[model samples]
Target chain A: MAKKKKAFDKLQWIAAYKSFVLEKGELPATVRELAEMAGQTFPDFKKQFTDLRQLETAVIALYFKEANDLLMADEKFEEYSNKEKQLAFLYVMIEKAGADEVFLQEFQRLKKTDRGFAVRLMRFLNRQELSWAELSWGASTAERVGVNPKQAALIQHALSTLMFFLKDYSEEKQDTDAYIEKTTDVLYRLTDTSTVRSMVDLGKFLFSRRKTTFSWE
Target chain B: MGQDKIAVSKYQRAGKLVNTGAKVGANYMKHYAKKLTGSKATKQDLEEENAKDDYSAFSELKGGPLKVAQMLSMGDQVLPKAYVDQFALAQNQVTPLSLPLVRKTFRKYFEKDPLQLFDEFSTEAVNAASIGQVHKGRKGKQEFAIKIQYPGVADSLQSDLRLIAPIATRFLGLKKKEVAPYFEEVERKLMEETDYRKELQNANEIISGCGNLEGIHFPEFDPQLSTDRIITMTWLKGLSLNDWLATDPSQEDRNRIGQLLWDFYQHQFHLLRVIHADPHPGNFIITPENELGVIDFGCIKHIPSDFYASYEKLMRSGQEQDSPELIDALFALELLHDGDSEKDQATIMGVFGSMFQLVGQPFYSETFDFSNDSFFEKIYSTGMALSKDSSYRNLSARGSRHFIYFNRTYFGLYQLLHQLKANIHTGQWTFIAA
Candidate 1:
């Protein structure tokens, strides 16, 4: 009974995290405030995390975890190729984010203002990259591909690029669908031809360095 | 196909129409001016000049204007032989959307370059039509034919029809109100044709309806690759009727292929009351094995139950030698209206009723030989004489609106089988209502 209560409590805070972002147009000003808004105390909020910054990181982490859970629950996931799995991941993430235009815009604005916010984005990218690598290479093939920083960076760049489009995608999302299909195709091609020569060329001058110039794909 | 981009903008399209109208007006003024000056410009000279301008305008502006031109060109009762022959070429001469425009169209609906969707996608269109163009594509081991519609065709068809109404009225010698029904019918079908999603639905319905049948094939449509303006389907393998004819197939081959077409139409019209409306030679492919391959479900006509029953009544009246009954059927079908005097009604019935007799002749016979040269000669000459007749011209310039596609399909079939020089079992529809 106590374990079930704890799980339910965690869910309440997650739901509160989403509603707070949606209603207040931002995360709580502080953990105590979040606790107060969620109808909990600071001690209770601290049980889940050490600080407000960790809670913010958890909010981003929750999105990926939910998407990954969906991927696992899907019966057809095993039938898809590694590239297809990555594409499926994108669709799942977009669906779960449920973050509408205002949420996306506010997050984007926050991105521009907060330098520390870059660390949260990097964490998100790293998690996505690891998920992609694990699905794409599996345990046996992953060692053959090696732990090349360039390969990791290329995926990071690709995910970061995809997020930018997903953030600004209109309600119809016809443009976003095209962007996902096209960018993933380019990523698949780059990964398939990942060799010493390709990796060297990629790493030498920001290989997979999507022009730092930001634009919707 | 011309290298120039298709005119999609309403203003640019209107500009083309205005230019055509200006030329026609200028030609008329020149004819009068020549007469006033006592120049030696014959009526034939003036006609040829106007025909040139009309063809250039309709054929050059290749969307709804060109489609209207093709319809008018096929109207034996409307255009002069010279104009008909000239405008018929408009069906062949079309301006394709450029590569950049095709890509842009794909992006608008699909949000991806077509190249990214398929392993191989042709840059140039293989077949370009008034509403869309088709490209060859391949994904993995599968081949596909992807159709990309010109942007804004759905929005522009209405305005285009409005602009062409007056011009079609003058050439066809009809009042504006009389011409409105024909253009409205054409517009309704054109709007449906421009919608690829609807075409996809039609394709599925047709495939299901015809699945168990032999000697006919409908391409498999991929919903994943299809949108409102774009459709990707499994590529059909066969030769177009003209290309197949060029290969000099045997008489047996011709007869076999012709029979497939005949039976297909009979089944659709009599049982289903639905027929493929656009039946030009391009929409049919005569396989090397003498089977028929039907493509382009873009335009389909569903004959209402009452209309079909009344049409059958007209045929039955013709069969029973009941002139009064035949006249009543015509009126019921809206072929002949209420206002005509008895004498005018008789003359109108005599003219159109004879045309119906010729159309019904095949069904009356056990097997009909389309290779009868004199029979075809009579069809053409009689059509020209009836169209050229002054008495018929005085009648209203409309018939049953369904007659537009009803006549198109039968006439197109007659012309096609005649070209094939085949003998067919036209007796299939005799027991249809049974």
Candidate 2:
């Protein structure tokens, strides 16, 4: 999320994009096509934008906007700690805004000969996801989980794998039942603490809903 | 002994053995590689290399250790169908060891005859292992498994490593300074493998260190019968996870076994502070109840306290885009080096970095599912790529480090579990990490 002028006329650009799309409503476009739509010369367009996804990324700011508004509108997400509340806020925002679908369609359009939005989409999800879920397991989580740092990292690594698997899975909604089921299965066996209830449980619920998956064999 | 045998002098015999063994090795891998990748390759090409290697080793493969080395290394990656078809037909493939050689191994390592100790010694080998053959016998009421070293195996190792060095380097692209760490690590492990006494010590340490771990089994040692060349452990029986998984076990079965395997490794990597570094399938047995039986402590890989700690940091740093600092730390830890040229270093880094990302992915997971073929493929393909780099022209003498055996062992074991589709959360990693 970069700062834009408070009174900048972004709507005007959107209107222009719509007009362009009216005649050029293809699934996605290459850098050449995007340059043509924007009424800019190819060389200048390439200079202005390193990739076509830069344009799509500019538009993706809208989803983040929707997410932010949803977060501001909801108060229950505020009841948790800084980390949990942040995750809860993002979870609710994405769910309410159909964030996954919007981003998927946007990404499909932006993925061309070279410009890939998958990493950008990942960067966005990662930016907003607001959980250490994707990061390597470190001392803090290891202590909380009662495993050595390496083993903790390994477990966390497994969770991250399921996250990647979810990205490639073709399904409706998200599921964390199995993730929770699987997580708690290992969690309970290792430690007797109930402290991971909210954090681990929430991760399970959201991630498992999308389809808890990945083949190890 | 026959006096009519060619009277090649000691140097001549050594030269012949070394050359023959080297050619045999070179030919086997080339032939095995062709057979495994048989798209454009023909039976003639396959047999041609096999013959070349066999012809080279013809003078030395006479009941020596090279035969077993061939078998184990062949099992490494997927062997081509043609090679399997060709080799499978040669049923009694390995050189048959003479009774005198077995007696001599006992006499040299332990001042006794093997048959003098065991209640009944089978003159015939029951099954062939990577570097040895198994003989069945009974001591009191217990059935036993005896792993007998091939005669002159000790003599074969240096030559094998020499022949293996150049190709292995090309396979992995290891450089000079890099060679010392890798081979130092490998030699240390290899030494334990050669010295059955050290392996016996390893077996005792691990069994006692892992005392009464539920679902874990260790064979009782008999010092009266053990020796430097032969290790006699109680013969245990069960289905390998490979065989078990092939039957398409339920997720419950997979998870149970996966968890056990994970827990066992965690214990070794952490508390015992020593690892049973061998990844050979024969080292493990998975039972009907999902119990894991680990044997063969001969291939033990050791980690200094500081090295393990540094390695833990390295594993953690690898999770993010932290290569610069990671490289620095790795250099500090001697895991990576500027040993080769700058370009070569960068190329090796790029190759290994990608693999680190893949292998390290499970570090972020709740638990890695060993059965995932895609995950396995990612790591395996990356490894194959890493091995094929020209920058590692001298890997054998350079890259064969002790620290690397852990990674190699795990890679091999994980491939087996990957096929089984086991979903082990490895709960005990948490306990060990604690």
Candidate 3:
């Protein structure tokens, strides 16, 4: 009789990989260790990913890939404005990465202790995010707007909001909705005239001692 | 042409206000100067001309000025009827963002094109309001009415209101001090309205609060698709009051619809003490079944327990016609001061008594027929007479500032009921035991 197959799909494998790195506080050195963390054997892990390095790379790509899948699965995604698609993309990634206090703490710890690993991880993340920005926003529009600055600002914004969310998000209660709104504000301010104007006003307010009184006309 | 985006900058908003103020001032000066020079215009004609200028300037403004315009239009004592008629347009006849600009706004809010978010999002807006415009959209099988606020509305609200305060008080026919609390109340509620997430929370609470009430319905709000500036709720199918009236439904139809509205306010006030305060005709819809569909929760007002208790007591005093009880109630409401002289106290009561009498009229009846043109005419005439009465004019805004909204709510309800000509059973919520 044929051997029983493991239930480890690509998404499950990605989840297992994330948990393995985050729980172990480092990348898994071997497939056996990753499989053990995933509650499967080495053979089961090999069926999904070839090696530890490949699995790590897949984990990064999977963030956007899975997010894209979600966007596609949502019938309304195509009908949404470009901004909404971008927000939905970011939300799905953050949610998939397990936007919780524990995840935030572990990630912070990894960044502090393992400089080389953090650099490699962030480089991959930055690359994937840029690709998404270009894809979701459309190449022509993204090109005109200079996708790099927008992408960089958005990534930094997403991280900053995650840190803020960690302050309030806990095991017993998670205010992801609030975090989504706060983070979305950054995107809005960056792109919309109103929010951008407010940002400029805020900057002026901070810099000037006297309050500015502009005309109502 | 101006910035290619909704000019939500405080400087821009203030600029608009200043320019409008200057123009209005110039017109007033010119009118007086013209009158002194023996022009053919009567005071009524001059008033009409001034009203025209005020409307043109205020109607161009998108945020605070328009909100104040709507509020002033609701009060009979606040503005001349011509000005009120012009300001009434501010409630529903708002300019819309261009399609490209609309797409840009969506892009800013969602970071994706709106087309990619909904299954079928209309580029054309179905309706527009002072704060935002509404678009019809579909996600799979479900339809939604997505309200997207004009950009920068929330960010610039404080500054806009600051600029509007002096100008608005003059328009509302109240002293700055007298109107401050009401402005604060409006500011608080308007701030909440800009935050769609808060509206979502309010919607859920209101749904639960009024879920058991018959003949009233609320749309299901989708949190996943909602943001502070953008709200997505299930599409409520119905006609606005004007549209329904044009269709000429039967008197029985009108009464059922009217009863639905009455019960909604009564249930909300006596039990919840939380009201959907913006009862502007645009905020409600009459379904094919004559059910009342409440669409906006942007201006939900929660009455303080003390205020509710005191107001209830005042109503009771009116019912019993007890002078001492009325005085006690006014004191409780903080409308009457302990330091007031006996003569001043009597003057306050004399002014408030007429106002209270009009307010209490419906409550004294078993079934009040609002369709009686005479009832509304009497109320309006009394309001005009009292406002002109030098003694009443001297009475500063007394009582809790909450009464501003409290009175506005009943006035709005009464106005709509009168339009519908529905006979409603009143005196039912005469007492609140709690």
Q: Compare candidates 1 and 2 on DockQ and give the better one.
A: 1
Q: What is the C-alpha DockQ of each candidate?
A: 0.02, 0.00, 0.02
RMSD of 3: 12.3
lDDT, model 1: 0.71
Better of 1 and 2 by TM-score: 1
Point out the worst 10-residue segment of candidate 2 chain A by lDDT: A172-181
lDDT tens string, model 2, B101-133?
A: 454456555766666677787766766543466
Which regions in candidate 2 have their CA more than 4 angstroms from the true location? A1-217, B1-93, B100-116, B166-178, B240-251, B323-328, B335-353, B384-400, B427-434
**Docking quality (DockQ) of candidate 3:** 0.02
Candidate 1 is graded, for docking, as incorrect
Shift of residue A195 alpha carbon in model 3, Å: 34
User: Each candidate's root-mean-square deviation in Å?
Assistant: 13.3, 32.0, 12.3
Summed over model 3, clashes come to: 38
For model 1, state the Cα shift of residue B139 in Å.
1.9
